[model samples]
Target chain A: MNLIEKYAAEVGKYLPSRNRADIEAEIRSTLEDMLEERAQAPNADREALTLQLLKEYGAPRKVAESYGAVQYLIGPRLYPIFEMVLKIVAAVLLGVGLLGFGVNAVRMDMAGPALVHALGKLFVDSFGGVMMAFGNIVLVFAVLERVLPLSDQKDLTDEWEPADLAKEQDPDRVKTSDLIAEIVFTVIFLALFNLYSQYVGIVIFNDNQWTFIPVLTEAFFRYMPWINLLWTLQIGLHVWLLRKGMWDVPTRLINLAFKLGSIGLAYAMLIGPAIIKVNTESLAGTSLAEVARELSPLSQFILVPFLIAMIIAPVVEIVQTVIYLVRRRSSVPFPVK
Target chain B: MENDELIQNMVFELRRGIISIAVLSLLGKEEYGYSLLKALSDQGLEVDQSTLYPLLRRLESQGLLQSDWRIVDEARPRRYYVISPQGREVLAQLKKEWASMTESMQKLLS
Candidate 1:
């Protein structure tokens, strides 16, 4: 009915139902006491005094918040990591979406309505991607906050030792950028191999029309299961390395195993039938027999050499990893400070 | 401005730490919220009503204080708080700690 009562009611609106009545009664009593003390002055207007006392108490919502226990969808412990992940995901989505739009726009007639249409599509697509990424990330963090155990949560704030500082600053520390790049590439590779295998081809522009000629044959699909497993493993490894913030012996050994597995798969593919379709019918202005002859040498010059390089690259990595492990063993470990 | 803010923050933290002890000491005698607040202010330890009221409820919930409503002559009932046995024990411990902390600080400052 009066200013104090109205203020208490407003504060009670923000408070939980269980304690609202009791808290409101307490606030009203305190307000009355303040009013009584203030009213002892000469010519004290009761209404004016009530308003002044309420103002000093703070906003109704703030008063309620002070009384309530602190609640967070994502608490301070996870906030920095959540923010970092959100930034990376949003940036990647926006970057890739816009890049795709840009390429398509450039291929269109620049002076026509098509370019404007493409620009509009670009805005809408990029906005949708960013929103989806943000929502998914927030949902994940909220779930993590609820399900993460108290002990595991200590990883966010546990004190670091001098040895940790040494490990972080070590010259051989795994580069975050390199690991991130590997993650991105592995994801793209997996998506293309599994989801868009049919679209893996060479685009030839002829007579103002673009034709996508299928380069990879059914033989490529045969290797899909193995390739998918390797790519998924690589992604998991990169994510672990990122969380660890440094690579140790076990990580290097896992990296070595991945390289060895990749080489073995590449070798298997090379020894098998040609993986490229080589559809002679798809060759424009050429007879089937002539096209077939042309494909035989092209496969040798292209596919064979490509497979050999894949094997050689992994062999080189294995040697380097071995050398790194040997060098690490001889070096003195970081002394405790 | 920064120095003033730093001092303000430090003073606030210092006051916050001792406010519970001050409240418990005053509530040794059963008093309603307004009277308890007035009693503290009269002793030169001014506290905001919003802070004091919530703190009283929290202490009560924690079993450090007990409260009951009393009605007088058909007027608005008042909720009165008093320090519990547990509160008295805690207050004694706090006083001992405060005395030792002040002694150590005095020596360090000197």
Candidate 2:
């Protein structure tokens, strides 16, 4: 390629893919035109003039950047939620790390340098695990940044109204944070249930290493397709709510429909085969062996309440939605200010 | 700041704010990037290629200008830009604002 061709290509590398060719062509044409003007002067050398033209045009990267392409991994519109998620994830990781450390420390019967060394090693290992978790979170957010539609990622071009804020009181307003949290959690559950279901069980430190016990049963896997369908629709709903920025009648009805689906799933899970299983046999010779033996049969007793609550909470929400669909209260729970 | 630096900075600020208005006004006729640059320079409104091209794209994206690439009196293909109907309306308003601003400044300075 010629010097101008090379220069344009370098600039094209930095432009967004959507408009890269057009921009590159424009830059090249402009440079050639400039060079043409300079060449009209007496004794002008074409190559020398081309070099001077490119120099005046500034560096290729700088020229490309002047177009103001979207530069964020997680842009300003999603930044607050990203920050909130990072904080929540960091705290949860720290709590789990400390809990793990305590369990390992309790398992240790040493009282001197051995205990310190083991504790030191455990701390280092936990720190590494936490760092890995943070990296995974960043990866997820980066993917989310690209995966979200341009309409959602970039600030909306629509005319905004201060009156809209006044109308969106506490109950009616869509909290971006709440929708984002819902999306994040639903995505996590989907990933966990589908990709990392084997690691869903209780992990016990045994025989000088960590042993992962798969807690979910085959019955749960049978229901996987249904669960995936519901969760996918649920994520779609959340994205719609995020873009709409408030709940109206139709969205509430849609949400009510999803909640009813949830009730169906919960009812089926309650009546059907077990979803979670604790194999005390797998926990033998570990720190949780005795506890597992005691609690394995009582796992249903622990799980039944949550399933019942899941059914009950959605029922109540459904009732409320029907009531609101009948008549929405005008009273705000508190002052707007 | 040095006097030269102060002058350059102040001139840059003045130029940056009005470049949009000037470009909008000048693009009443369809012109490609280089022709547009020369047109502006001929009228003594100095602007960088970096500034002008991006501004053109931005204004187009904002629905104020329309552009398309076609060969126009040149062997090379060039992206020609013209003021849109929306741009004409905006430019009229901007022109009024500019006139009022300059008039007020003239009064204050006098």
Candidate 3:
């Protein structure tokens, strides 16, 4: 149509479909009113003035944005399941990558720099594969986003209370040994941290004698009461889980609490201060000197960040705990007399 | 420049809060979009076209304003907006609120 009509149509492109036609007509009407008023002024050229009026009004996209048309591709209703599926896909990709890497390494019969070169190349080649996998997932979710109607939100949403996970025959039964093992482990860990924290440091046999460097900061000790409370409650939770012989709501909740506490404590230690110390000078003339330089002082007194793998263990454990908590509740049936 | 921007934003917010009341008060007499803009401007309440049209549509959607597309004086069709019964009741309450608010504000400012 005309220039003003074209501008209105352009603005209509970004408006929500329900309001698009009505808004476009209103915009065209307003623009004509503006043009008529401006063109009546002295030295007014209708074509030049219409162009300036549209320019002053702003770009089509921006004018449309001012109306606040928010459309989420994958809304909150599907986001949780999307995240779980994404995590599963990532883990599968990592597993496949490792398998391929192992097979390639075995077949090549390469060593030293050649193996390192192959490993580096493997990572570089992985970028394309990861992008493709990620793209496919997003496409699937985008389709699902539009296909799922608003009426089905209640049926699909996680508003319902989490159900009890146990089967009728043995739903409430706790694997007794798991709790016992955890209790023993936590107790020994508490003893090591609380009773003998000073011995928990880097000891080097230098000058034909052992020298221990104390490295736990004040921040680390300040966290001790909270840490002690968490571990003690952890032991108590295990004991209660055993005595009860099943996970009740309260038991699971307490476990989640202590689990959160441990997470908070670990996160604080990770970000706050060096909870453990190592002396590079002490490790001089030793192979560990380079490693000591690589390792940041861990804030975990009990976690014993000797291996980085152990630090990650707590995170993996908490994730599984959350899944377990979401899946199961105490659903024991009363017996008939 | 920054202070000017800040004051402009604050003024915008102030107008946004009260523009509804002003529109409802004036819409006792039916006015189309351009004519309503003119009426508001004539009363020294210069509202943006973008802001006013959307507001008219929204207020209509909310059942506070009634509108219909009609041509007058053999001219082009325009959506004429008038206050709904609900809008009159809301405006009556809002006038009392505005009076009370201005009284307190005057006391604070003085």
Candidate 4:
């Protein structure tokens, strides 16, 4: 084959398979055109002219890239979200893993090999969590980049308006960080509640053994369906708020409903049969009756205060929502200087 | 040399955006890849062969241009491109936009 044919073949290797033949044909024709223009001298060798034209055109890969179909595992449009998601997931995973390790280390003999063993476990678990998070995030974004339409992939390419700046300057705009944190925590809570409910308990280290005492009673389990429903709703609300990037009336109303539902669940748990059942016999040096009497007042101290906060927090939110509605209605400009 | 490279790069970017409009406007008269390149260069657009060929395929794919291959009795076959009706409509709109933008920029600079 001649220089023009060789050049076209080399460029074809880099092109997408479906259009390779057509593209190579066009490139060859264009190369001939360039050669004819350059080799205007009467005695110019055609082979030398072809070589000179190919040099000026560019390398095969560079010429192919000019077609503007560069391949990407995760494209620019999805890259920012992918990066943010990976960071948040890694942070949450590392936090939980280290907290578990710290608790286990405290329970172990500090001077012994047990502490070393706990540290090793922490390293392995945290590394595995981070790798899994990265892989999953990349896979999800790759799929999204493939499936999403050009219009939907507007995060990178959308034309900005002055109104967008005004929206950014809005004082009552929803904080993305807060919404992401809520999403992460709600997902963790739901996963543990549904799949690992047994681990959601109190553990005591006594007599060189770890004793996991069940804290939540069957009555608590009974209320879980409603609690799970509310948690799911809250997660949905947070995700929607994240997508919207700002809080409006409808979202606030939805958030108000979620708060009320959560309060109701908390109230039900308070009024129901006792949720924590501490087996006093498992207490290292204490008698059952003595442990029970001591624990009763302590449990009340924790539970009663928690219940009050649950109710009060939602009530305060409801009042605040009403005030915000009134303020918004009065045409008070946002982002007060 | 650095300043020359910078100017070349800026001019390249400026030309890239209008290359489609330029090509579409010229292909109102049917011409193959090589002739079209000659026509554009004659008009002082100076588009590269590689860039022009790919752009023609892309515009054709986007339904803005149509192509057909013709073979004469003693000549190698050549694929010719012509502006579609769709291309004409888009070209008109682009020309209006270009006019308005030039006027606006001129005012701003003055």
Q: Compared with the true structure, what per-residue lDDT tens digits does model 2 show for residues A1-337? A: 9999999999988889999998898888888888877799788899888888888889888888898854777777678888888798788766765665566557555567765666566566557655755666667677667766655432366655556666745677777677777788787678778877875755445455555567788898999999999999999998788766678777887898899999999999999999998877765886778856754676688689999998999999899778865555344454322
Tens digits of per-residue lDDT for model 3, A169-283: 3544676545544554465456657776764554332232333455565667888899788888787676566556667656756766776666677777777656665656766
Q: Could you give the interface RMSD of candidate 2 in angstroms?
A: 0.6
Compute the lDDT for candidate 1: 0.74
How accurate locally is residue B28 in candidate 2, as Cα lDDT from 0 to 100? 89
Clashing pairs in model 1, backbone N/Cα/C closer than 3 A: none
Cα error of candidate 1 at position A133, Å? 4.3
Tell me the whole-model lDDT of each prediction, alpha carbons only: 0.74, 0.80, 0.72, 0.74
- Evaluated against the true structure, the overall lDDT of model 4 is 0.74
**Model 3 residue pairs with clashes:** A165-A329
Scored by lDDT, model 3 comes in at 0.72
The candidate, 1 or 4, that scores higher on DockQ is: 1
Best by lDDT: 2
Identify the leading candidate in terms of DockQ: 2
Residue A68's C-alpha lDDT in candidate 2? 83
- Residue B98, candidate 2: Cα error in Å is 2.8
Candidate 4 lDDT over residue span A1-337, tens digit each: 9889898999988888888888888788777766877789899888877777788889999998988747789777656666777777778776766665565456454546766655665575346546754665566567546654464323345564656755655656666545655665566667666766766544333333444455566777888889888888887787666566668777888888888888887787778787666556555464334534444456557677888898988999899988978777777666322
Q: What is the Å distance of residue A307 in model 3 from its true position? A: 32
Taking candidate 3, what TM-score does its chain B reach relative to the real chain B? 0.96
At residue A21, candidate 3 shows an lDDT of 88
How does each model score on TM-score?
0.54, 0.80, 0.56, 0.57
lDDT of 1 by residue, A1-337 (tens): 8778899999988888888888888788777766777899999898877777778889998999889745678887667767677677667666755654564445443546756655665565346535644665576567657654444332356464556745646755656545554565466556556766655544332233334456777787899889989888998887677566667788888889999999999999899977875566657564333535454466567788999999999999899889877876877586211
Overall local distance difference test of candidate 2 = 0.80
